[model samples]
Target chain A: MKRIAKLSTLSVLVLIMVFVAACGKSGNNNNNASPSPKASEAAAAPAAESAAASESSQPADKKVVLGFAQVGAESGWRSANTKSIQESAATAGFDLKFSDAQQKQENQIKAIRSYIQQKVDVIAFSPVVESGWDTVLKEAKEAGIPVILTDRAVDSEDTSLYKTFIGSDFVEEGRKAGQWLVDQYKDASGEVNIVELQGTTGSAPANDRKSGFLDVITSNPNLKIIASQTGDFTRAKGKEVMQAFLQANKKIDVLYAHNDDMALGAIQAIEAAGLKPGVDIKIISVDGVHDGIQAASEGKINFIVECNPLLGPQLMTAVNDVLAGKDIPLRIVTEEGTFTSEQALAALPNRQY
Target chain B: MNRMFRHHLFWPLAILAALLLFNLFYSPDFFNIVMRNGHMYGSLIDILNFGAPLVLVAIGMTLVIATKGIDLSVGSIVAIAGALACLTISRGTDQNALSLVLSAVGLTVGLSFFLGAWNGFLVATTGIQPIIATLILMVAGRGIAQLITSGQIITVTSDTYNYIGNGALAALPFSIFIVAAIYLIVSLLTRKTALGLFIESVGCNPQASRLIGIRSRLIIITVYMFCGLCAGIAGLILSSNVASADGNNAGLWYELDAILAVVIGGTSLNGGRFYLTGTVIGALIIQTLTTTIYMIGVPPEITLVVKAFVVLTVCLIQSEVFRKKVVQRWKTRRYPAEREVSRHV
Candidate 1:
C-alpha cells in the first residue's frame, strides 16, 4: 500500500508537470523545455534546433503569443472588462492565453510565472493588489519578457520592469463626475445639499473617487455633502442606504454614487420618496454601464462619468507597438468620455458593454 | 409577567427594543410612518422591507439549527434562485406577464428543493458531517448560479415580479406580508404537529431516535428542504426588489447573517431547542442596527468595527451564564466581608 501510494503521488506530480508544459506549448511551441517524458521519442537536441530555426526563419509572420491574466468576474464591470479583453484579442488576431486569477494575488503570481515559463511574446495582467509583485516581475524582467500592466498598477518602485501601463484613471473618473456636478451648479445660488453614496470603504477606486470628487467640489463651498455612507457598491445596499438618507435628511439636492449601480438604486429610492430623481435631485455617478446609461437617457440620472472598461483596443495596440520595439510611453490612459442625459440617449445605441 | 421575562424570546426582544429605543432617541424621525400613495413609508417600515429577505432566511435557518445542521449554502442558494428566476423572465418575450413571472418563481423554488435535497442526501444517507455537506453546495452553488446567468447580471423589467418585493398591500410593504405568512405557517407546522418533536428528538440523538422508531433521516431532509424553500423565496424578494439578478453579489454573506440571527434567537449549535419568534426578533435587531448606523452617520471606515462591537455586546447579554458570572463577580467586589462569610459557610 505504501509503495502504491508513493507511485500514485509521483504520477500525479508528473501529470501536473506535463499539463503545465502542454499549456505552455499551446500558447507558443517555441519553448524548448516543454517536451515531457512522454514525448521523449524525439531527440531533444535536434528538436530544440529545429524549433529555434523555425522561429528565426519567419519571426515576423509568427503570431505574437500574448498571455493576459485577469482578476475574477466579481461584478458587471469586471465581466465587461473581461469580454472586451477577450473580444479585442480575437479581433487583433494575437495568440492569446488567458488566466482568471479569481481575485487572488497568489493565483495571479502563479499565472504570471507560468506565462514566463511558457515564454509567450508578452505578459499582461491587472494586478490584484499593488504590493507583493516585485519578485515575480523581477523574474519576468530577467527573462527579457516585456510586461504590461492593465486596469490596475503595481506598487513596485522599479518601473522599468513593465513596458507600459494601460487603464482608466480612477481618480480622474471621479474628478469628471465632480467636475460635471460643479459646472452644473455653477450658476445656482442656494446651498446644494448632496447625499453621497460611496463604494466599499478602503478600496482603491472608492478612496480615490471620494478624494477626487471632494477635491473638485471643494471649489464650491455651497456644495456640501450632508451624508456620506458606503453602500458597499451593490444595488440593494445602495437602495437601503439611500432610503435611510432620505429618511434622515428632509431635503437632499443631489446624490453622487461611486458607481452606476448605486446611482440606479438611489433613483428607485428617490422615486419611492415621492421625489423626482433627475428633476428634484440631480444624480451623478461613475461607470457608464448599460443600465446606468439607460437610466441617464431617461433623465433619471443627471450625468455620468464613464470609467470605461473597454481597454482591449488600446492594449492590443500597445502590445503590437512593444513587439515592434517602439518606445511607448510609461502610461497610456484609455480615452473615456463624460455623458449628459442628452449624450446618454445619443450614445445608447452604440454602447458595447 | 414573570414567565414572560423568562421566555426564551425575551432577551432577543429586549435587545431589539433597546436598539429601537436608541434609534428613537438619536433620530426621532426613525419612527415616523406616513401614508404615501396609500402605502406606508418610514425608517421602521424600511427595516421590515429591506430586512424581509434576512427574516425569511433566518426563519428557515432556525429549524435547520434545531436539527443540529448548519446551511452555509443558503447564501449560494439565494444567488442561484435569483439567477434562475431572472434568467427565465429575461428569456420571455413579455417579462411583465404574470404567467412568465409565476413560472420563473415556480422554477426557482423547485430547483431550490432539489438543491436542498442534495444537501440532505449527503448528510443523512451518506453520513457526511452537516457543515462539510453544506459547504460543497456553498461553493459549487455560486458557480452554478454564475453559469445560469452566463456570468452576467440579468436585468428583467417585470412589475408583477417586482410586486413580491416593492409592492405594498393594505398600507404595508408586500414583503412584510410574505414574511409574516411564512412565519405563521412554520409556527403552525412545528407547534401543531409531532414533526417538531421528531426534529428535536433526532437533533438530540440520531441513533437513539432511530432505535425509538423515529424517521430521523426524513426529518433532517425535510428541514433542509424547507430551509431551501425559504432561501428560494428570499432570493425572489431580493432580485425583485432590485429588478435584477446579480449572481456574484446577490445574497452574499447571507448564510453567515442568517446563522447569526439563529444564534441570536437562542438556538443552540448543539441543536434540540429552537424559537422561531426569537429568530424573527434577532433578524429585526440586525436590520434595526444597520439602519441606526446609517442614520447616526457612522464613519464608513469604522462601520464594521461598530457593528462587531454591537453584535458582541448582544451575544454577551444573551448568555445567562455570562450574566450570572458578571453579577457574582460584582457582588464579591462590592462586599469583601460577604465573600469571606460565604467562604466560611
Candidate 2:
C-alpha cells in the first residue's frame, strides 16, 4: 500500500513539474508572438473592408466568419486540397475557421453545433461518408448558416440545406476510367481478368466510383472484375489486398484502383510477382497525384484520371459570392480531365497541386 | 548490474553494434551529423522524429501485453482523439483558452476511456478475447473518425496546437521530449510499484492472481485504458505535426507497427514478462532499419519485404529450437575444457 501511494505521488509530482515546464515555455512563446496576432489582424482589417465594399455596401464591421468542417487527411490529395483551401481563405480575406472531422460524422456534428453557436456566416464540410448528415445539415439550416459541400457530396435530398456544392464528379471520374479501358481492350479475346482496389468502404468516393465504373463495365461483357476488395485508399493496404488478389486469381490482366495510392500499392505487388505492370497488367486509377503522375510518365502506370485538389481559389470565390447574396449555382463542378502517359510526362514538371 | 549485462538484451545490443559497423563501411555519410541552431540535424534526427510515435505506442503496448492483452484499436483511437481535438478548436468562435483546451482534452480522454472501458468490459465481463474486442474497434474506429471529419481533412492554424508536435525544446523536437517524458512517467509508475508484479502474475496465471485478490479484471481494464490514453496523445502529436486531421490515414496501420515493435522487443504476444526499455530499443531498431533502407536508395516498395525478413530473422533467432541448435554447434566448435565450463555455467 505504501509503495503504491509512493508511486502515485511520484507520478503526480512528475506530471505537475512537466506541466509547469510546458506552461513556462508556452508563456514565453505567447509573449513573443502576442503582438504579431494583433498586427496581422489589423493589417487584415483594411483588406477585409475593401472585400466587403466590393461585395456589398453592408457595414464593413459586419464580419462574416466561416467555419469549414473538413474530412481528415485521408490521402496526399486530401492534404493538398486542405492546403489549397487554407491558403485561399487567407488570401481571399474571409475569416475562415477549419475543423478536421478526422472522417467521423459525430465530430462533424459537434463542429456544426459549435459553428452554429459561434453564429458564423457559413458552414461547409466534405462528408466522410454519404449517410447520417441530414440531421446535422438540417440543424445548420435551422441556425441560418448556409452549408457547402466540397470534394465528396452528401446523401441529403433537400437542396435547400446547402448553398452550393463545389467538387469533382467522382462517378464521372470512374466512368471515364472504365470507358478508357473499354476503348483500349475492345478487341481482347479471353476473359479480361481485372482486379479492383477500392477506396474506403461506405465512403462517397468508394461508392460513387464503384457504381460508376461498374455501370460502364456492365455494358461490355469482356472486362470482368474477378476480385474486388477495399484498400481503404492506402498504399500499404492496397499492396496487401492486391497480393491477395494475385494469390486468388491466376490471370489478372487489368488493375483498376479507386485512387493513386492503391494503384501504386498494386504496382508494387505486380512488380514483386516479376510481372510488367504497364504491359502485362494495365493500370488505371484516379487522383493524379505527383507520385502517380511520375509513375504514369515512367510507364509503370498506364492511365490516370485527374481529381483537381486545388479547390481553394474556387471555394473562396464561392464563399465571397455567397456572402454577397448573389445567385449561385446549386453545383459548381471543377473542370478536370484524364491524363495519358504522354500527357502525364509532359505535365509532371508543371503540376503544382 | 552484472547480472543485467548477462540478460538477453546483451545479444541484441551486440547484433545492433555489428549492424552499425557494417553500415559504416557500406554506406556513405552513415555517421555524419550536421549541427544547426545548436541542435543536431541529419537523417538520424528525422528517423527519431518519425519513429517517436511508434515508440510511444510500443511502450504502451508492452504494458498491455504484459497483462496478456492486445490493443488493435490504437490506430483508430489516434484518429478519434485527433479528430476530436481539431474539431473542438476549429469552431471559429470566441474560444476561451481554458475552455478550448479543457474541452479538447476532455473529449479526447473521455472518448478514449469509453473505448478502453468497452474493450475491458468485453474481455473481463463477457469473456471475449482482448484481440477480438479490440479488433471490432480497430475496424470501426477509422469509419467513426471519418464521420467526425465529414470526409475532409480539417486544417487549422492554431500555433498553440501546432507546438505540440512541431515545436522544439532547446534543440530537440517536441515529440522526442514528449515521448521521453511519457517513458519516464510510465517507467516510474510500473517499476516503482507492485503494478508490474501484479501484471506479470495475472499474465502468468489469472486464477492465481484472482486467488490472491489482485482484481485481475480491473488490472486488465486499467492497462487497456492506459493504452487508449497513450494512443490519444499520439494522435494529438501526429495531427498537430501535420496541422491537419485526416481520419482515413492518421495512424493508419499503426497497430501493426506497434505489435511488431513489442514483438521485436522480445515481448511474447502470449504475455508474461514486459520490458519498456526493450520496446524503446525495438522502436529505434525499426526506425534505424527504415532510415538505412532509404539511405541505401532501396525502392520504397521493397520496405515491407525487408521488414518482414527482419522480423522473421529475429523471431527465428529467439525460437527455442534454433537456440538449442546454436548452443549445440557452439559447444562442438569450442575446446573440450571450454565446452565443459560453458555447459556447467
Candidate 3:
C-alpha cells in the first residue's frame, strides 16, 4: 500500500509539472492577458484613432474602451489575426475587452451581451456564422453600442446592424484565385484537368471559393474540373486526397486548393509520386500565409492569392469614425496583393502572418 | 502447427490477404517496392509506413480491450505529446543537438505516462467508468495542447527530430523499427513472465482472481499506463511526419480507428483471449482500406460510408451465430437424420 501511494504521488507530480510547463509556454506568447477591472490606459480606442487621423482632437485624456469578441482559435490565420488585433488595440491606447467564442455561436452571443453589460463604447465581433445574429445586433443597438464586423460578414441582410463590414470579399477572393488560372492557360490547346482541394464541407470559404473558381473556369471549354473533394482545410487530408486523385486519374495538370495549407500538403503528395509540384502540376492557392508565401518563393506552389487577416487598424479606424459622429461605408474592403514565383521572393521577407 | 493455423489471428490475416488481393486487381504494381534513396518506395511500403501509428496505438488498445477497458484518452495524449515535444525542441537554441532531441522525447513520454496514470487512478481508485474517465482527458487534452502550441502550428526544422518521422533505415521507415521494438518489449514482458496470465485471470474473473491472491488493481492500472505510453510514441511519429504540431487535427479521431482495430482483431470487449498479432493485422486492414479509397478515387464524403460498409462486412463474417446458421442450413437439409444419429452415438 505504501509503495502504491508513493507511485501515485510521483505520477501526480509529473502531471502537475507537464501542466505548469504548458501554461507557462502559452502565457509567455499570449501578449494580452485578460483585461483588468479598472481601465488604466488613457484614451483607449477613440483617442488613438483620432491621433492617427488628425493632429489634434479634443478631450484626448478620456479613455476609449472597445470590446472585441473573436471567433476562437480555429486556424493559423485566426491566431495571427487575434495577435494583430490585440497588438493594435494596445498601440492605439484602447482598453480592449476581448472574449474568445471557441467556434460556438452561443458563446459569441454571450460575449456580445457581456460587452453590452460592461457598457463599452463600441462592440465588435467576428461572427462564427452569418445567420441568427439579428437578435444580438438588435440588442447591441438597444444598448446604444455600435458594432463592427471583421474578417467575415453576417447574412442578416440588415446592413444597418453594423456600421461597416471591414474584411475581404469572399466572392472576390475566390474570383481572384480563378482569374489567375484562366490567364495562365488562356492559350491551352488541350483540356486542363484541374482537381480542387476544398475547405470544410459547407463553410463560407468552401462554398464561395468553389463558385468563384467555377464561374471563371466553367466558361472556358478546355478547362474542366475532373474531381472536387473536401480536404477539410487540413494538410494531412490534402495529401491523402491528392494521392487519391493521382491514382484514379492518369493525367492531372492543374491543382487548386482553397487555402495555402492544403496546397502545401498537396505539394508533398505530388513530390512523393516522383513529380515536381509547381513544374508538373500548376498549383494555385489562397490565404498567402507565411508557409504559402515561402512555398511560392521556393517554386513548390505556383501562384497565391492573398487574403489578409490583419484587420486591426481598419476595424479600429471604423469604430473611431463612427464614434466621431462621421458616416462610414457599410462595406470597407482591405487591399490585398497576389504573388507569383517572382513576386514571392520580393514579398516573402515582409510576410509576417 | 495445427494449433497455430486455428489461432484467432488466422482470420484477421486472411482478411488482410483478401484486401491485398483486391488491391492487386485495382493496380497491378501494388505489391512492387523499389529502392529509392535507400528507402523502399511503393504502395506496399506506404501502407506499412503510414499504418505504423495505427499499429502502435492498436497494440496498446488490444491489451486495454482484453482487460475489458478502453483508453479514449490516447488520442488526446497524442496531441499533448506532439505539442510538448515540438515546444521543447523549438524553445531550445540547439534543435540539432542529440541531447536536446532525446530530452524532448523523454519529456513527451513522461507526460504521456502521467496522463495514463491519471486515467488508471480515476478508474481504479475513484471507480469512474473507463470511458467517462478517459473521455475527460480526451476533450481536455486537445485544449491543453492548443494552449501549449498557443493555437498555432509549431513547425520545427531539425534533422534529428525529422529522422524519427521521415528517416528510413534498411529500406524501411524508422517508424516500423520503433513499433517492432515496442511490440517485442511488451510480448517479452507478458509471455516470458507470469504477467500475461495474471492479466488474463484478472480480466476473466476479478473476484476469483482476487480470492486467489492476484493483484487485479495493479494489472488494470499497468495496462492503461502502457496504452498512454503507446499513444505518446504515436504522437511523436505523427508530428514528426508533418514536422509540425496541430492541436486540433493531429491524431483526430485516431482513437476510433484504434478501437476498431482492436475489435476487428477478434479481441472481445468482454475481456480474455487477446492476440497481439491479430491486432497488427487488423491495423493493416484499416490502413489498406484508407489506401484503397485514395487509389480508387472515392469521393471524400463517401470515404466514411465505404469504410462503414467494409467494417460491417468484416464483423458479419466474424459472427459465430451467422457462421453456425449458414452451416446448420446445409446439415439440416442434406443430413438431418444423420446429424441426429451422430449426436446420439
Best by DockQ: 1
lDDT for model 2 comes to 0.77
Supply candidate 2's per-residue lDDT for A287: 96
lDDT of 2 by residue, A132-233 (tens): 888888888888888888888888888888889999999999899999999998887877988787887778899888889999988789899776777778
Best by TM-score: 1
Each model's TM-score?
0.87, 0.55, 0.83
lDDT of 1: 0.86
Can you write out model 2's per-residue Cα lDDT over B201-315, one digit (the tens) per residue?
8888888999989999898888888888888888888776656676888888899889888877778888879888878877777777655554443433355687678768777
lDDT of 3 by residue, A1-353 (tens): 97898788768757876986787557755546543223214224433664475323325677688999998765677777887787667666677888777667899999999999999998888877667899989999888899998987788877788888888877787888889888988999999999999877545677788898899887778999898888877776787678667766769999999988888778877876778999999999988888888889999888888888877867767767887889988889988888898899899886667
lDDT of each: 0.86, 0.77, 0.83
Off by over 4 Å in 3: A1-47, A50-74, A90-149, A153-165, A317-330, B1-7, B10-22, B27-32, B205-207, B321-345
The predicted structure with the larger lDDT, 1 or 3, is: 1
Q: Could you tell me the TM-score of chain A in candidate 3?
A: 0.83
| Candidate 2 CAPRI assessment class | incorrect
Model 3 / residue A231 / CA error / Å: 2.3
